[model samples]
Every structure is written in C-alpha cells, then in structure tokens.
Target: MAASRMYLSAKRAAALDAELMSSGGFSLDQLMELAGLSCAQAVYKSHPPESKRNVLIIAGPGNNGGDGLVAARHLKLFGYNPIVYYPKRPNKDLYNRLVTQLSNLKVSFTDDIDMAITETDQILDAIFGFSFQPPIRDPFVHVIGLLELTKKPVTSVDIPSSWDVDSGPPKTGELGAGFVPDVLVSLTAPKPAAKFFKGTHFLGGRFVSKEIAEKWGFSLPNYPGVDQVVELPVDNEKL
Candidate 1:
C-alpha cells in the first residue's frame, strides 16, 4: 500500500531540497534530469501527444525554469512538439546547456507568446515553482495575464505560476484568480498550496528516499513499478 502523503511548507521544501543535494550527494543536474523526465512522463501519460501535440512551455528564470527546459527535451523525445518561451534567462552554464539541448533538438522557441499560444494546443506553466512570492513583475506580469486569458490546458510545474507556496492562490487580486491549471505536477512532494488544485494531480520527482523523508518529517507514496511519475487521487475525486 502507498504511504499517506503530506503537504510541505515552503521553508521545509527548501530545506529538504538542500539536504537532497548536500548530504544526499545528488547533483543539481541529476535532480533536474529526474524531475524534468518525470514531468514529461506525467504529461504524456495524462494528455498524450496524439491529442495535445504542440506545447507552449512558458519557462521562467529560476531552477523552476530549468526544470521546464529539461521537460521540453524529454517531451520532444516522447513525440510531442514543445515550444519554449523563456523571456528572462539565468547566466548559469547549466541553464545555457539546457537551452542549447532544446535548440539542438529542433524545438521551436518564441518571443511572441501570443503567437505561440495561438498555434499551440496546450500550455506548460513552468514559469514558477515552490519558492515564488507576492507581486508579479516584468514580462511575467504580462505572461500571467495571457495565461489567465487562455482556454488551453495549463500543466503547472511544482506549484502553479505566481501562486503562494503555502497560502495557495490570491485572495482579492487578478494575480492568480481562477488560474487553476488543468493539470498540476507536484515535484518531490506536494506543497501546502496543492489543496487548492482541483485538476488531475500527478506526483513526480520520484527520488525521495527513506532517509530524506524521515529527515523532512514527511511521508510519500511509492511510484508504481518502474514509473517515474504517479497519478494521485484527490479525496474529492476518488471518493
């Protein structure tokens, strides 16, 4: 039987991540590779490439964006068309290689998100992750506006774009109003905000070991067989 799941706070989430890399001996690239691959597998299993082929991945400038970059590469290998819209990029070499890998795969990238959205069948909201906070800014401010206006199914990575990691969506503003994604892929473990998500929820990043879970004071369900991702039943849904 799968273990009972727990929702982690933003502070604990960051601490667990640090422990995974520092003490667990997992490299950043290794973790991102696992995360992005799991994300690709989850999306493929749920949406399928035959129906939702063209994916508009709105990547941000953080490690969250790096995950998207890695996901784009895997999605392509899975026979889906992935187009990336990375407005602001980090100066790190890891990010540079991710972009280069996507470019080498002949994946299309666009500066005009409007045009990209029009052409794509679905959207991947890899714009932000667990550590995000408060008021939106720059290109993303406009990007979030575009995402809200769209009818496309948005698959958010870790946390939905512009969402508070623990408090969930906004209260009285347009920042995250009615912006619930069609699919939510929670990495490592689900965040406290995941309670707000009503869509098909998937738990990926299947690398959490017994030690890490113990250290973090959390429990995680096992991934079925050799699968890198697993569909989690929302109590409201499977009941």
Candidate 2:
C-alpha cells in the first residue's frame, strides 16, 4: 500500500503529467479533453441529472481549470445545466479556446458565486492540482472557504482544492482545506492524498496506457469496456 503502484507522491504525479505530454505523445488539449470527458462521465454516473441537474464548476487558472471547462462542456451535452465560475482565468491560448467552446455551447459563466452556490445542486472543485503549494492565496482561498460552508455536494477534480497532493487534507483546520468533497475523481492514478478522502471515490482519465503506467510505476485499474471512468473501491484502512 505504501508503494507507488497505487498512491503517487506529489513529485511522482508531476513527473507523470510531464511524461504524458513528452513521451506519451499527448498534446495539452488532447489530455485535457480526455480528462475532462472522464470527469463528466464520472459525475454522470455518480450523480445523474435526475438526482442533480444544475452543477457549479469552480475553476482555477492552470491546466486543472482547463479540465473543468472541458467537463462543463461535456456535462452540458449530457443534459445537465453547468454554470462555470472562473475567478482567475489564465490568458493561455488553450484556455481561451476552451472557454470559447463552452461559450459557444451557451454554458453560463456566472459572476455571482453566492447565487450560484445557492441555486446549484452540486459543485465541481477544480481550484487546485498536484503542484499546488501551501498558504492558499487570494480569491481561491475565499472561494474554497465558501465551498466549505455550502451544503451542495462537491465533486473534486483530481485532488480537492488547496489540499496537499501527497499528505492529504490539512489538519490545522485551515479554512481553505477544511471541506471534504462528496465525490472525488482521481485522474491518471490515485494520489497519496486520496487515501485520506472519504467519499464515493472514482478513477477518471483512462488515457494512461499500459506503457506509461509501467514507466510511472503505478498500476492502472481495470476500466471495463469503453467506459471513460471507473468507480474505485476505496478501503481507507488498507490504503
């Protein structure tokens, strides 16, 4: 259980992300699309539109945000109304393209977080990723703290926002890391922090080929058929 075969450290997760682009022959958009689709599928399976139709996706400024945008697009196509709240939008070309795609789909980008939180049935936390460091800053901190107060179910992308990738959630009762999302979607492979996550955990992003898995020293879970995401049986005690 302590091996890298199941749980990846922060360093290892970053290395695998780079290797996917470099040696794995995946372009940035390609990977983000795959990840985003998987995230959307996971959400559909976990919380169907009948259960929760309106979703509020809180995106950040990096690749994680790009993934959230992609998911929002897919979720809209899946018959769910998705409203995106991107506080710190990055000026990258890829991000611009993603936003344009979602905008074209008529997905709402709300400026009112409080209103969105009140009306939305669920929240997708994409405010941080594996490379995130401590001391959550600016609008992100305030937004994460807001999530902690919301009763709406949360589905975190990759790792929960503002959490340590390797060590899991903060123990000091930090406002930024206090919330435990109801659903967690682990991309590529489960990170070490996933062991601390108590929810309906899922393994999304089925883009990791067997070669890449072997190279990264993490065992990929069996994804049945053409499924984009697989629900992982998480036993925290064994983890």
Candidate 3:
C-alpha cells in the first residue's frame, strides 16, 4: 500500500542515492552491500535452502552488476550454489573486489549462459538496474534472448533488465522485450517500472534516513520481526 503511493523516476532515484551518500554519510559500497544481501535474502525466503538451491546470476558492467556479484557471495553463504555469468565486467575497484570475493567463495563463473540456465533452478536478473537504457547491445542482446526462451522463474534486482526506468517495459511487436520477473526486489524504494510487476515484490534497503524519506516523500515499509525484506502486495489491476 505504501509502496504503491511512491514511484521514483530514474532521476529521483539517483538524487536519493546522492543525498544519502553526501548528507547521510552512507557510502556507495555500503548501499550495494545491503542491496545485494537483501536480494539474496529474498531469494532464500522464496525458494528456501532445502529446495531449488541452484541459482544463475546474470551481472552487467554497472552498479547493478556489483549488486549481483554481492548477491552471489551471500547466496553461497546461504547454502545455495550460485554461478555468475558476467559478460561485461566494470574496471572499478569495487567491482573487482566483488569478483574476487565471489571467486574466494568458490562461486564459479560460466561463459555458456544457456547451459548455466539449464543447470540452475532460479535466475537472478541483475543484468541491469534503473540506469539501463534502450535497444540492448552486444552480448547482452544475445544473452537476454536466451533467457527469454527459458521457462525458469527470474528474480530481478532493483529493476528488470531491458526495461525503461519511467515507462516500464519496451514493446517488442505485440509483446514486451524485457524479462518479466517472478519476484522483484526494490532497493531503497520502488521505481516507476515496478508498476508493471505482477509477482512477489520485496522492498529492501533499510538504511534510508528519515530525513531522506521525508525530503523525497518516500513511504518506508515496516519489515516484520527481524526480517531484512518486506513483501509488497501486488495489484493485478495496475498490472
């Protein structure tokens, strides 16, 4: 209910991140850590450790990819075998550190996306976040096409890959080009594209300051007990 009332655009989300880091004293690394951990927790809650323990994480070259990398590490710790498929890795220290962390955890990296998809029970769509734009390029285009062919359930972090931050999914003839996630984990707050999501949705990122929430008019949801993630009720009519 509170999530439905607040929909952050790409610009607003960026501003919130900046404000949080500059004034709130939260580092980018800190946010990414919490975000990725929350995503892993969501997957663990949905599938559990006893069932469907294998996950395929598709990471990109941006902050979203970093989040995926972080999620892979946490997933491994949670007793799930997570394999990462990072075609385009960023040259930043943070990303490199994440890759190293995953490697240290013995999480293998796969070059064959199709094969990895077949072996895994669930897919983590961390290929793109709120910053992703239009006509998908290169290896990602091919990779996304392969993912579309699978019947496996996908859980997207922040926003679904290939989706417009403000306009939801891109039209592919009569259908949408983006991968429709079975579960969406929104970090900090729900983005505009989340309006199109019609599945289990969880709101993460508990580090947002009260000042930031009031300033941006973000309605924070209350997590039950000691849970790090809160499930939001989906509105089929809106979808």
TM per candidate comes to 0.94, 0.94, 0.95
Question: In model 1, where do residues sit more than 4 Å from their true spots?
Answer: 1-4, 235-239
- Provide the overall lDDT of each model, using Cα atoms, as 2-decimal numbers: 0.86, 0.86, 0.86
**TM-score: which is higher, 1 or 3?**
3
**Which residue pairs in model 1 clash with each other?**
none
User: Mind giving the per-residue lDDT tens digits that candidate 2 earns over 79-152?
Assistant: 99999999888788899999999999999998888889999999988888888987888877778889888888
| Local accuracy of candidate 1 as per-residue lDDT tens digits, 76-180 | 999999999999999999999999999999998899998998899998888888888767888988888888789998899999997898988877666767577
- What C-alpha lDDT does candidate 1 achieve relative to the native structure? 0.86
Clashes of 2: 0
The clash count for each model shown is: 0, 0, 0
